[model samples]
Each structure stands twice: as C-alpha cells, then as structure tokens.
Target: TPLPTSSPRSSPNILITGTPGTGKTTAAGMVADAAGLELVTVGDLIKQRNLHDGYNEEFDTYWLNEDKVVDEMEEMMAGGGMCIDFHTCGFFPERWFDLVVVLRAGTQQVYDRLKSRGYKQNKIEENLDCEIMQVVADEARESYKAEIIMELTSNTIEDMEDNVEKIVAFVNGFRSSHK
Candidate 1:
C-alpha cells in the first residue's frame, strides 16, 4: 500500500525512540503531557491491538508485524499531535513525524535498567551492545531528515528533564511555525 502523506494539524507529531532501557517511554510521557500532545506508546498499542506476529522467546518480546502496525497507525500519525514512543523507528513512514527524538543512555545505565526489569543476561548484553553501537540512532539517521532528528542522552533524571524541556520548546516552535 502507498504511504499516506502527513495531513495538517494543530501540533506536530513527535517520535521518541531508542534502545529498550533508554527511557523512551518516560521522556515521551513527559513531553506529551507538557506539550499537550497525545501519547501513543507503540509497544502498548501493539499488545492491545495484537499487531504482532507472535512473541519471541529469545528477546522475550513481540515479533511486531510492521505492516499491521503501520496500517493501524497511519491515519492517526497523518493527523499529527502525537507523541509516539517506541524502541525503533525504521518502519514508520518518514513523513509521519515532524521530529524524532532518539534517546541514548550509557551502557552501564542501560544494563542496570534492563537487569532490574528482569531481562535475561543475554538480552541485557544485546541491548547494551546495541546502545553502545548507537544502532537506534543510526536507524533514525537513515530513516529521517537530519534536521528533524535529535539524539539526546538519557542517562540521568536531569537529562530526562532537559530532554523534556527541549522537546516542549520544539513543539511550541512547531506550533507557531506550522500555524
């Protein structure tokens, strides 16, 4: 199916994405609340809508069906004003987002967070490697315009707060310019 073009809306659609333990969800919620945008946690949406093929034993996560996810989210994404949170960003249409925030955390911080969440040793190691390698940030660069992508450190509470502030400011700027 052809990808839909982004439609006009009152506010911009922001995408918060990174590796699993990088605080994507927390930052997304803060930015959404502070900027008055709707929060769409893609992981929750996938679970709620059964938008995945099946669960992956190794990763202890869903094998997401990208087509199904895009089909379900296309209309809402096109309309904008969404703070979409997920661990990855390559599949979504490039035009669907006005800004993409790629959160990054220190390897030790990511490892601790994943471990606390009960991630298996292998899973935790893999995620730490991915974060160290900047895999998600690379994906964002490949998928979106450089001007619209922001790579922010998410290692501390202060970093999270700063990220939220920067994003809210971006939203305000977007609102004014797009109007």
Candidate 2:
C-alpha cells in the first residue's frame, strides 16, 4: 500500500509497542511496510549505536542510557515517516508520536511465545505478568492523548492484519485533518 500523503509540514510518527513476545516488532514492520514508512527499532538502534549503559545478566537485556537514547532518537522522530518498535513507550515524548499502538496478548500465549524463543522461565513469567497488568498500555495512555492511543490484540495473523488496516485509516485521517 502506498503511504498516505501527509501534510507538507510533517510526516506522521507512529509507535508500535507492547510486552515482549506480543508481536510488536512483527506488527511494526508490517505496518511500516504497508504504510511505506521507515521502521526503527529501539533495541536495534541502541545496539547499532552502542548506546547501552550496561548489560544486565539476570535479565539478559541491556541497560540503555535512557537520556542518550532519547537524544539520539530526537532527529529521527522529528523527521517522521518513522514507525518505532519498542517494549517501552512511556519514555518517549508525547509529541513525538502521531499515534501509539499497544499490542496485547494473553498470559499463556505470551509465555508460550517467549518460551519458544528460549527465554528463561522467570523472564517469560515476568513478561506475562507485564502483559496481564497492562503496563505498556497504561504507559501509552499516560503519555499520549486518548485519540492517539490504540490498543490491539496480536494473538493471531487476522488480528495483526486488522491492526495494520486500522493504523492505515488512522494515519489517513490524521493527514487529512492536518492538511
């Protein structure tokens, strides 16, 4: 699908986020490709730029320097046509995203998904808990306007397709209004 012709002033900045194993990266890539937007993943960016503060052996995840990551991303976020994929959304400035999509999946589904990826039992359980608690969605709500925050399920291919369509329509609408 061709990208919506956004206002000359700016292109839309979209964020796709959710708990680990919730298909955030997959959906973000699909949406970005369908919408002809550029895809930027927080983890990839951090690793590429060596922006991590340190590594956490317990979680097997990097401790990113939040401020440094934000600073590095400021330019890309401002440039637009960017679909950002990440597990955390609250750290980003609200104005940076035109829309924030929070993907949800059931605890068992998340646990299964993570386990399939060789995640430790503890990590899998922790992520399942995060999903169950709606932590990411709550963070998006606190960061963005009600109209700009959308929650979608990522439990199946059909759900993901539906979410991509919804996002396209939303971007079209946002562009129309801005124009």
Candidate 3:
C-alpha cells in the first residue's frame, strides 16, 4: 500500500515496537511526553495485570493472552492519545492504532545493550537475529497501513531525538488538520 503524505489522525493511538534492546521504550516515552499522550508498556501491563496465560522458562518470557490485552486496551485506544510500547505489537488489531513506529538498531549495538541487561545468551542471540532480519519492521508493515507504519533507526542518541521530534510533528500536524 502507498504511504500517506499526511498524518493519519488527530490524537492518534500510536504503537512503538521493535526488537529487544532497540530503545523502543525510551523513544516511546519521549514521544508520549512530547505528544501529550499516555504511554502503555505492554510488558509492564502483563505483569501488573497478570494478563498472561503462563510463563515460559526457556525464554524467560510470558505467554501473553492476546485477548486480555485487547480487552484491557480497546477502550483506551478508542479514546485516542495513547502510545502503546512493546516489542511485539503485530498481534494487535489494525483498528486500534493510527500510527506504528518500528525502531531498529545495529546488531552489535543490540547485542551489547541486551548484554548490559544481563539477558541470557540465547535470548540475546534471538534478539540480535530479529534485528538483523528486520522482523519488527516487517511485522509493523504487515499489520498496519504503509502510511501508518514508520521505520526509525535508534542506534544513537541523535537518532532517538530526531525520531521523537518527527513523531511530535506528526501528532501536532494531525491535531491541526482535525481542527
């Protein structure tokens, strides 16, 4: 699908997703602050709300209940002005978000960052492979309209700052257009 040249909606519901250790959470926080949107970190949501069906010992990850997440988020998404932050967002219904940002980083950088978090070797490798293969970007594109799906590189501070500025501009433009 062709990408739209203009912002998609006023007070848009946004999704910020990427491979692990790719600076998605940090960038999402910045975007939410700059855009005056509420941030929802899915991992935290799963833990706080116990929204998962079970835990996986091998990956040290939860088997999230997709329905529970949708049930919890549908109302907030309908109201708009929400930034959903998570590594896995493709499963979310397309109607829920107006924009989706897929953050990416160099494989080496992702490896180091995950390492700093003390992630298991297998997990770190998995993330590195995902980044290398652009899994996050692919997922976003498949789930959302091309115009609503943006790919941003966040391997450096400057890149992150630029991404935040771009998202803020998009939000402001959307608001203005609606007005």
Best-fitting candidate, measured by lDDT? 1
Best by TM-score: 1
> Compared with the true structure, what per-residue lDDT tens digits does model 2 show for residues 4-103?
3333435688889999999989888888888878999999999889888888888888997888889999987776778999999888887787778899
Using Cα atoms with residue i matched to residue i, what is each candidate's TM-score against the true structure? 0.94, 0.92, 0.93
lDDT of all predictions: 0.89, 0.83, 0.85
Worst 10-residue lDDT window, candidate 2:
1-10
lDDT of 2: 0.83
Listed per model in order, the count of residue pairs whose N, CA or C atoms clash below 3 Å is 0, 0, 0
* 1 versus 3: better lDDT goes to: 1
The digit string of per-residue lDDT tens for model 1 on 117-178 reads 99999999889889989999999999998888988999999999999999998888778766
Error of 2 at 15 (Å): 0.6
Whichever of 1 and 2 has more lDDT, that candidate is 1
Candidate 3 residue lDDT tens string, 11-86:
7777889998999899989998888999999999999999998898888999989999989888878877899999
Q: How many clashing residue pairs, candidate 3?
A: 0
The residue pairs in collision within model 1 are: none
